[model samples]
Target: MCFSMFRSKSKNSSIIQPGKFTPSNTNINPTALNSPSSRSHSQSKSRSNEFNSKSSSISSRASLSSLKDSLPENPHIYDLSEIRSATSNFLLRPFSSSSSSTSWKCLIDKKQLIVTQRKLRRPIDNSELRRKLSLLCKSHHASLVKLHGASVSGNYLYLVYEFICGANLSDCLRNPRNPNFTVLSNWISRVQIIAGIADGLDYMHNCAGFKNGFIHNHVKSSSIVICEEPALVAKICHFGTAQLCGEVPEAISGEDDDDSSNYHVLKRVGSAVGKFVGTRGYMSPEFQTTGIPTLKSDVFAFGVVLLELLSGEEPMKVHVDSGSGAFRKVSLIETAREAVGSGTGRLRQWVDRRLRDSYPVEVADGLARVALECVLEDPGRRPDMGRVAGWISKYYLESKTWAQNIGLPDEITVSFAPR
Candidate 1:
């Protein structure tokens, strides 16, 4: 009996040894742990995990690249030396030269660009100038020419723009070589041009995200270009000229409080002091009197341009009185008003003879009325650009419907040669 108890105790001690493997204590298989097939399965799983890790890294990199591409390109600030080098140290012949500004079409960094030089009207610090430039460069629209960048050399601010191949609206309308012919010969083309200008102006006045309303101090036929390749599209130039040149006052910059009282104060102060600069005939009466460029002034100028589009004449013309042998200034606005006030037949007669009386007379009459409202002497009485754009859009649709009913072709080939 003693021997039997000792055997049972020795067996239990063997089963319960700390390092000994037992079926109930552990699930490891000795054969599976060392077999070639099991080793192959373990290696396969390790490779799968490694591949998944690499795939995750690749996916992460692709996502980062996509995000980088989505962001807007930052505006370039060109060095003065670079501008000088591009223009051959200011020896290159200017593309367009005027008393107030000069432009040069040159290659910069292998990209074609138009560099315009204008005298700075006021002194701005580097920080403020950079801020203004950043804002200007960020704003983009199909109807507005893009401002690539700008450079400052002493009192001159050199504005760089993407070189667009097109003719100015003034030259397209009134070619000196072909006085009787105009590129905007069709009624729909004229309507399209005015509608585009109205939309661009409305955007500048109300939808540009400007804290204060943007004022285009220069709104004239010469400031617009007509692109005729794929389609007839009008692009407004000198988009940020007023702001950069300090033609806009601090009160109108939206830097101060935005309120009617402040605006009234600005008008009074602007009228009371400061010399004004603007294209003749396009300037509103208030702008002429107060020397303050305002949103209403832009509207007045747009009205004049619209009338010019209708009449196919310059904004202001000198007519010699055959009877009196005296020169009289005949305003397009006056003629438009007279034509609309008289009757439909008078308006039909007043419409650009180039159209050959193809346009809808009623639509023309309504457009003339709208233009008159815009040119009203009182700034307060004139409609805002938003309303003007709305009217033009309505007229444009009407004109399109009229064209379709008449089976007029959309495209009309015309000479695009520069005057």
Candidate 2:
């Protein structure tokens, strides 16, 4: 059924044959169609198609390799030859901007490079750790951060990545008095960001490779970078503290706890010590009280991030009960509940004082629901990250669709803009 080409002679002239034409006896080699002086026209087309198929297969394999090699612990170390070929003799220069203990520069060839080599506080061999990271990197969707390429030399690693130049979500919330503060992020953006974070986590836990259960052990403001667009893109970063599930023994099956009160499951059962690990405010209640760490614990940390994004205040700093210092605060969720309100309605005072008249009630309420859901004490009660991502994406789609349908002004873009 494969139609091809041929040359025909009409009296004194030669032209391409015009009709359904397939090789009658099939003598075509199907590889040299590109040759300038192929004697048979029919053979040329067949050969061209064969070359295309082979090229496509090679492209697919290359893509698979790219996805496999970028894990943090097992970074795809690029051989000098490959890099030289990609960058046309490695004549690239460093980026000019430097901040936050890392120097970020774009290569002349348009590749982004991050340069930092903090002396490892502890030395460890983790090739297996890098493989687990590969699993996490490959499963990313819109909600998750993208991992590009990385290199290793002794204890130092050079992580080359897609450069996202945007301020962390905290800056906007912290400086409400600025002109840009007037265009302050709304509750909708918060919901979208929170939902995206949850989805990224869910993918790591359930749908990723057989051994991929990554608990982003650290989730905080500095870690999330918001993109410059509507429906804010929150990219999760800094996996230095991440724990890959399969590499270590699974003490209780991931499905061990159906009961919400079973904090005991979070306690480390084997040789691994489960002490005070992640960032303070974001740490789960179970992990804070008892040294138990689980996927739910990560969820709890995500909930704290969600609350901070929505309220425009650090979760731990929001509810001050007279005597307790800012750093020595109690449960963020409890304080957020009191600040946002109890049961029926929200408290106006609890809203970020800086938001002033800008924050809308509906958006705030929606974020509250997402934040509360993420922070629920029982792990079972919390929605999985996939479900969270779906809900967030649905909300985003619906908002855009509604605006389009009603002909509302599309003035809202998620990036930080001046009032």
Candidate 3:
């Protein structure tokens, strides 16, 4: 009977415990130990401490797990359909806000949609990007493009931006139908453009603590957009490839090539392979060689852009159709040399044929000189954006004076100073 009673007690204990276990030394059931009446006061106090410890540990783990979920693990791609629908089919809609990093616009339903898909495997350390974007959004200026808002959902990010409705400076230069096509943009317009660009750059350099290292890197005909005023409104875009002002090689990509023919072709032409990180002809020699991009690097690209505006020829095109020989491989600089060697008046011949009849030669010459100085081989020798802005402004003022002195028709005056 004693043995039978022992077996029944063991079965009862198993039923009560289920998955939970009590120490052999503890005569009390672990669950029962928690009840106030089941344990002595001292034991009850100890049991409470144990329960609190367990609860605290579980709470900490849950908090940590939740924190991890908030960060994006990868760049999430959305269906193009989703993007289209969210954007209300890209139909005309007003946006309450905008940002350059992503596209946001109103849809038919009047709800705003942000479209940004992260391209990189790792998410951009967004703290820096956010800080910069914030600064850009707050500042108001003519040259800088406007920023609206940012969208973040999981790994998806979108930047809403104001849509600019005008031809990029490059399109204006290359357009055969543009009446003002070849003339060096009137001295006034060029100056205004230059000054406005400087103001934007100045703010970028100093106001946001963004001085020194970051460069627009890609300055070309297509980069600058002209507004209704026919103003050379510089819309600096594409910060994706921007080099950090003070960081290591981790920030940039490296490429390798060993084509002597390509090298020879570039050398003869006074430009680089013009591939990879920057536009081929516009990149500085240093950027081509060492990846040492900086403010001076941007100045070099800007100089090339100015030259294109004046000359109306692609910087690398000078080498494109040359007759077979070392002459065929002649670099842009050499090509310019050959053209100039023809005569002092030959410089006028090199200007875009389209603008030949309309542009003032003196204005063209001045801008050309500025371009040359901007593209100097030594970064230190290149003029700062401030100086360039000032020079352009002066030229613009002088052109206005020249136009008035000649008693040009009202159309000419209005064209020079558009409302």
Candidate with top lDDT is 1
Whole-model alpha-carbon lDDT for candidate 3:
0.51
lDDT of 2: 0.54
TM-score of each: 0.80, 0.62, 0.57
Q: Using alpha carbons, what is the TM-score of model 3?
A: 0.57
How do the residues 1-419 of candidate 2 rate in per-residue lDDT, one tens digit apiece? 00011111111112558898786786756567556566466577789889998999999899888867643333454443544444344344433222322434444245444432222323334575466446645554544545544544465444444455556556555655663462344544554556556666776666666443556665677666666544345566644334432212345554335543332243235544533444657776666776546666766777777777665666665445567554444565776778666642454555655555344455555566777887887666776555555665666555545455666443446545444
Q: Per-model C-alpha lDDT, please?
A: 0.79, 0.54, 0.51
lDDT per residue for candidate 3 within 1-419, as digits (tens), equals: 00000001110012453686675774756787586676687587789888998998899899889978743233222344555667765463533222322234443224333333332222344565465455445544455444444434444455443455455566555656765553234544544455455555544544434433345555666656555433234555433234321111233322226421111111112333333345668878877786545666777787777666656666675344546533343334434554545654887787666543454567666766777777888776777666676676667666666666766321221131224
Per lDDT, what order, best first?
1, 2, 3
Give the range where candidate 2 is weakest over 10 consecutive residues by summed lDDT. Answer: 1-10
What is the per-residue lDDT of model 1 for residues 35-81, given as tens digits with 9 covering 90 to 100? 89999998998999999999999999999999897544566778999
Candidates 2 and 3 compared by TM-score, better number = 2
List runs of model 2 lying over 4 Å from the truth. 1-75, 78-110, 115-130, 149-160, 176-183, 210-212, 229-232, 239-241, 244-254, 257-276, 289-293, 318-332, 339-345, 352-363, 393-411, 414-419
lDDT of 1 at 138: 76
Q: Model 1 — TM-score against the truth?
A: 0.80
Task: Please tell me which predicted candidate would have the highest TM-score against the true structure.
Answer: 1
Candidate 3 lDDT for residue 17: 36
